[model samples]
Target: MIEFRRNIVAGTAVLVVAAVSGCAPGTGDRAQPATTATGTSMVTSPTAVPGTLVYLDVAAGRPITMTTVTDGAARRTTFGTATRSDEHVLVPSPDATRLAAVESPDPDSVAPGDLVVISAGGARHTVATKVMWGGGSAPVWMPDGQHVIAAVGGQWRVIDVANGAATPYPAGPRPGADGGYLTWSTNGHWRAIGGSTDVTVTAADGTGEVKRSVASLPECREAAGCPTSVQAVSDDGRYVALGHMNSDPSRVTEAHLVLDMRTGGLVNLPPTAPGGSVDRVFFRPDGGMVVRTVTNDGRYTFVLLRADGSTLATLPDTTQQHPSGRNLVTYRP
Candidate 1:
């Protein structure tokens, strides 16, 4: 039921007619414009506030972006043609300093042309060497803004924002999945890879410490090996979100699992209802957990919880707080 980011990151398709070779890693301290023909008009404002939220509105023909500050101010920018909802997107850094986005060559192409780095100062720097086709997860910003973590071609790589060079992650081989796969908690020292049969947690040294079989879970189908798959990890690397294989047409429940990397404990969160299910599971920027669930009636519920699984507040609609613009705190990285 956890909709991991195959195309969860939202953005508009760039309609540039031509493709340009990217600059080298040592491209100097200046903020480089990834595309000279970037179609977006500039909206000069103070640097994006620390708690600013960046999200795309795919409802219109184009993706309209809303960036809202913590103090109740919001700016709206609409990009070109509305792109596929499934494409990868640039996640804001933990500090909100920079973002790693995918820039496309053509307006209608499904594959992204390159990885572009956008700064809070409105600078666009393209990692031209890092072309992405079939992006696995949304680009994740490391604790620092200098690097990003992404899954491309079934492999996870840490990409430098300034240069296009990619470095192999310390994690072991890529795990299997029924559909798009995204690893959670990239900033943490511990990571879990959920396979068709079991879920395995490993340390930075690639040592597997916990292995639990999910093959017989009621939410699993025989067609897909394991029912639960790993999604987002917490900033502290103590928790992981394990998504269920709900995309398959078979009779698998949409429930997902939240794993504790340190204690090796697993909490199987059942679906919210007959017609409802859990959408996203992640630890907030403040180390609290957020579970966005769709009720049986189809209303979106945002449940904020403490690190120890205690409930904080459940906002039926975050829009109540930001009356003027869309509040997106659920999209996966």
Candidate 2:
């Protein structure tokens, strides 16, 4: 039993608010733990991804623990009793009932290893520990929460959580000639295959493929180098966040764009907030943008942007995000 920092937190917003497990925080970052409120007003579309909980191992130890700030307090749960710390990647199942971590015993090497699946209740299991290696790749959960997917050795495989069995997964996209990443839309209907030169979006079931080059996207190409790649897709699969980084820091600041996947339209986004550079971006179920910014000094902030690329709220003293996508969670030591 380990103690984690508070998940449920209150904070200063641009009128932003934070919460945990359906409970809202008080008025500031130091808000004390409060009794949980019952009921959730969260409405979901038929295609909405059901997020169970925001979880991962914040630290490694004998009894591996995953935590989240819930109800204005830290909530730590033991999910890894005997799991090895060398397993560098920690991914939570979409349903939050289990976790997937690389079971690599050698921390220094990026060699293949078995992948372990540990239930939130502390049940540990695996399929191919020595077959997959870490190349900055992570296990991703499908929106349905029934399967876990990973790209191994440039090939893709899907694991059925129920039986710990795996089979080849036909992820649509030729391997990038110059290294790339595979990301899923929030609803799991769209897969974004991004590389240095181009990006392709296609249906998860392998249909409706659209490919665009870095030079073709607006504000990229000759103007600001090239659109690096799409960082995140909106939950509704209507918008995507694209980024372009400047090679020469003195000449260009990082540039970002919100591309409408439905209409091929592009909207520029603000690259910086109070904290620092925007480090991460995700779309809320309602098509709002959840932007996490990190300053040069290492502090973090969560800013919410409307669908039209306007700031909805700037949450202060927030770090970790709730998996529910509605609020940001603050962690206090």
Candidate 3:
């Protein structure tokens, strides 16, 4: 599932507080020097990097729109009418040359959905498929842009853009187990499946090997207790961010973790806020950091962290309408 921002307001305020404790130094003469408070500190208006565009699904009757923020200024750009479904909006290529989105003509057509590749030059190509469910989520592009990994039917499939052919991977347990939810490592050697009974990874070659399982992780529940959910793997494939949903599917809780794919060791992330769940995870262009979100009340906060689970920065809160609904957030590398 793609992570999206819900509401976009003009501006918001973030408050930082510093704590101080009173104490006395042992001693003497009648008066002791005043001890200065040190340690905890709060920084307001932390400068954030510019040039990041967040595609938001606003409530106003339109499809989807782009919200760009540079420094502290914000602008909105209209990108034509988008698919009305809840699928994610694809991020354009690094050069903004091409964009890949999942388009469905109707709700019930067999090959209802197609991969719509749009170029900045205005050329378009529609790659239709029958192997997977047309109503599946957005398509993720490989580094070369010649291949896209998407979930169709109940399995993961890779589409060769050259000829529009799709090759399906082995099906994980469960009916309607569409691998529609997936995360691709930046190196292209590994891919992770979200919304499964167990967190599964496979080789990019369709080798069908189960590289790791979430059940074996320290905190993941077994098949009987595991909740149906989605996860995002880091660009380097070193971390997997999993979202846990309640049985009713109305609420979700997220845990950010780093797993050594080679060893299956897991590291839990420190809490970002008291309450709120993770929306999605995406690696920064440089692959040195990953971006994730924590939603509390009706507001969403974006966090940038190192691969090892250290917090780098927490962006200002942005307003959102629905906290339970899925939102897509993509990084342009």
Worst 10 residues of 2 by lDDT: 1-10
What lDDT would candidate 1 get against the real structure? 0.47
TM-score of each: 0.59, 0.64, 0.59
Clashing pairs in 1: 7-86, 34-124, 184-231, 184-232, 184-233, 185-233, 196-225, 196-226
RMSD of 3: 14.4
lDDT of 3 by residue, 44-118 (tens): 223563334344443323534545554446555554555442233344543334566655555334343666676
Best by TM-score: 2
Local error of candidate 3 at residue 61 (angstroms): 5.7
lDDT of 1 at 213: 67
* Cα lDDT tens digits for candidate 1, 1-333: 112211222231211111111211111132322333222211122132223344434333444353544423555554334334313354455554455566555525444355666654446676643344332334555544577766555456788777767888665544442234445443444555655556665544454445656655555665544455566665444456776553421112122466644334465443475777776676543444557677655466656553234455565644323333343533322
Off by over 4 Å in 2: 1-57, 69-74, 81-87, 152-154, 174-180, 215-231, 236-238, 242-266, 271-275, 317-333
Candidate 2 global Cα RMSD: 12.8
Residue-level lDDT for 121 in candidate 3:
36
Give each model's clash number. Answer: 8, 15, 16
Which of the predicted structures, 2 or 3, would earn the higher lDDT when compared with the native? 2
Which 10 successive residues of model 1 have the least lDDT summed? 12-21
- Considering lDDT, where higher is better, how would the candidates rank from best to worst? 2, 1, 3
